[model samples]
Target: MDKRPSVLVIGDLMLDRYITGTASRLSPEAPVPVILYQSNEDRPGGAANVALNLVAMGCDVTLVGVIGEDAEGELLLSLLLSPHIDTSNIEADSQRPTTSKTRIMAGAHQVARVDREIASDVWEHHAHTFLRLVRKMLRPESIGGHPFDAVVFSDYAKGVVTEDLVRKAVENARFCGEDGIPVIVDPKRKDFRAYKGATLITPNVAEIQLATGKSVGSNEEASTVAQDVAERYECSVLLTRSEKGMLLCDKENGLKTMLITSRPVSVSDVSGAGDTVVAAVAAGLARGLDLEAACRHAEVAAEIAVSKPGTSIVTEAEIIKREAAA
Candidate 1:
């Protein structure tokens, strides 16, 4: 029997394109510098990046999201089709363009970014289809009586994570029994109510303030806010504070809060760091780690992710090496 944990990632999917060049001179018409065309590369972004992170950590991952029937979408799918990842649930819609972020990089620094996407909620039929897919994936008989261990909602506020979708997913997970699978959400919406009933939520300091209108500047403040949010939502909350580390408040097993301090490392690009955190945490939970231990694993994963340039992922071997070094 294959006992490896399986994770289902659902939400916005995008492609990140990087155009690297040298900007030695300014433009003639405007003040912007002229980027000497050098090289360009594309990688999976958004929810797809989360799936990648999970796969790199040795988890069986299934990615579910909406993409357009366009070239960019094809490219994104191609990049995501890996031996450990199942993309059978990713659907294509012709009415919308695939979400993409094109960054113009001058050497190692990003000068500007161009985004092409539709911010509106997915069509009703699409949402219905997505819900059906989720139900099927959660059904034990769907995969020879082996169900997913965890479900992650990687919301980028990019239209795929609707309120209905979140609610339905939670309900379906609860219906499966076995104490119900853990539903984790990396929320971006201003309204925290949309993510209610999730087993856990990973929100950064800025997101907490934006969603709850409470500024968390100190460790004490972060603890208070995390507790308040967890109580309000009746779920655990992992509040990520850059540099200060992460504060986790688990409501499921008493209102206990643990602050995992961040490691001191030379920071590079922080792009996709949140995705890495959520992915690591979800993989840990799926593998039967408690919330605090899972969060500590995430902290380490995030440290490794930010040390590299651009959106990056850490493999299980990298994590082991870091652990041995520590």
Candidate 2:
């Protein structure tokens, strides 16, 4: 039997398209540069990116989210399938088009971004169906009769992760008994009340400020803010500070803060770095690592993720190579 950790990711799904070209002159119609066509690339985004990062780290991943019944949705599914991510629980919505973000890049710089998505909450029936699917996937019989080791909520505030979904997930974990799995949340909403009772929530400094109305400029300030947020949410908090690294505070640990310094690397792009961090942390927690160790692993993963362009994934090999070099 394979002992690899199995992770279930639930949230919004999107397609990230990069249109790269050369820009020599500005468009007469607008202030934007005229990008000469070069090439285009597409990759899974949002929660799907979390699953991709987990898979690259050699974990068994199952992704559940909502996508449209359009061609963009088909393309997104195809890309996910290519990575061997289990998309069996993804539901298609006919009322909205698939969420897609197209970045117009000139050489290495992004010139403009075009977004296509429905910002409203999913329909009531869709939410019900999504909850049903979540319950089914959480069952032991869903994947070779083995329960998932971890559950990740990758919320983009795109409406796939509803308050009911988060509540149901917590209830499901409780139903799993003593081995109650860890539920990790990558929160994006300004109001984080829905995420209460989760095992851990990984939010960046800016997100922390947005949710808690507190700014984190230094290590001590971040620690104070993390404790406040953790107490409010009644769970552990991993506060990701781009260059300053990560700060973790948990009530289980008596709210004693732990800091993990960031690894030195030249960042190429910060897109999807949050997803990578949460994925690494989830994988580590699923494999039974402590929060501190998991956060350390996540820091390394984030370092590698930002070193690449666009939405990228960090493999186990890359982590090993970086470790050896360090």
Candidate 3:
């Protein structure tokens, strides 16, 4: 923990804008309640949020992804370009606007959400720039070692994460050492195979069901499904079950899978909780912690994340404070 672990984050990056206020009147044109706009706050979202989470964990972070040639993109950069984070690899796409999600909150309740993005494959728009940067990061220098201690593939199913990218990143990353650094993936794509060779993949109940068409109604069933998927994909599985906590069926542990139960708390919102888990786990690994230890710590971090509203951040100090209190 003395040194900051360098982490590379590659995936779809975006901005999250929150509009919080009180709503008392119904809209004259529609039946929905009208929300009188109060104040708006913008934060890094998607993969950008992952970078933020890592930086909060005291990691030296580098972000690589596509952004729009727009004001929103500029705002995102301003928020994320910090002393702890390197944003040099992030590229801009003129054809598409920056991906942004605007959420309207009526006090504690979410009234509505508006998203601005092009959901298609963005390879045509940013492949050349992305591939070049990725390869550069992956390439080994003859000096000390690889720049990163961990690599995170935060796939939002946007055009950024590709099958080719995954393979190449892992392939070139082996130069870090004989064992190579841990490759952690926060997968959103239905087909789990695209994230093959990752050290671990964090998926929730719905993602599990969609990827393998299996029922996760029970703990035993969920474990079986997770083990199968992990085996099929040739990586470990860290299954995040909202209230039930998380299940870790790691390939590194053979047939052993540990399910860490969630601590009882008031759940606010589940959005971006998985990102916290990914960041915590990757940070733990970068700091020389094993996957099991990483996941246990990540569970604590995620529990903290869900207790707060919106795509908020969880820091190492906060997590340490929480553990001390516990």
Candidate 4:
């Protein structure tokens, strides 16, 4: 862990816009709260937020995804550029507008949201360019003869993370000689098989149920379903169970599930906590922590992330501080 661990992030990227104002009365046209126009703000969302988390934890990140040929894309690119984050692989497609969610907040509550996006696979040229970039990064001689330590697939189901694309990416990353790069998935796809050759999959209770068609209301149920998905998909499972902590099961450890308990705190908005969890796990693996240890680190990172208001960044120092107190 002497040098910075370089990580590659690929998936769906979106822009989160918020327009907050005061609400005094209900709208006459419809049964909705009337929000007085105040101000507008935008933030990098989805996979972009995952990149933010990785860079905050001191990892060098290369972000790959598709955006729109619009001003929102321009603003998102500006927000994503940093000393540690390389946004060169992010493509801007003219076929669709940038995926964006604009929430109208009345005082402290969100009244309504407007989303603009097209849910479809990446266009042919975009897909080819993405594959080329993936291949380039996998090569040891690509940039400074340094291959990525880990790859994070932060899927938001916005059509960027296609099955064929994931298959090719996983194949290349898993077979690049003896020291294979780890591919971690923060999956939004209902089929876990789409990420068959991945090293780890981070799914919450809701996702676990949908992916496996099972009811996971209790810890035991979650364990059963998690194992089913892990073994079936040929990948390890890092099930994030919110207040119940996390469960880690993998073939490397004989599928012995370990529950990494969540440190209880005052819960705020859990908007982008998953992005932080995936970023922390990828960064932890890059820094040489085993799966269980890395998951423990993610538990602490997510705890800190959820305690803050809306989607917020947690720094390496903050995580270290929280761990020391624990």
RMSD of each: 1.8, 2.1, 1.5, 1.9
* Candidate 3 stretches greater than 4 Å from native: 140-144
TM-score against truth, every candidate: 0.96, 0.95, 0.96, 0.95
lDDT of each: 0.90, 0.89, 0.89, 0.87
115-143 in candidate 3: lDDT tens per residue?
99987878564776677766777666664
> Which lDDT tens digits does candidate 1 get at residues 1-326?
65678899999999999999999999999999999999999989999999999999989898999999999999999999788899988989999999999999999899999999998998888899988887676664434443688999999998899888888888878756466788999999997898888999999998999998988998888888899999898889999888998999999768788889888988888999999999999999898898888999999998999999899988878887887788
Candidate 1 weakest ten by summed lDDT: 138-147
* Residue-by-residue lDDT tens digits, candidate 2, 66-97: 99999999999988874457888888999999
Poorly placed runs, candidate 2 (over 4 Å): 82-84, 139-146
Clashing pairs in 1: none
lDDT value for candidate 4? Answer: 0.87
The deviation in Å at residue 249 for candidate 3 is 0.7
Better of 3 and 4 by TM-score: 3
* Consecutive 10-residue window with the lowest summed lDDT within model 3: 137-146
Using lDDT as the measure, the top candidate is 1
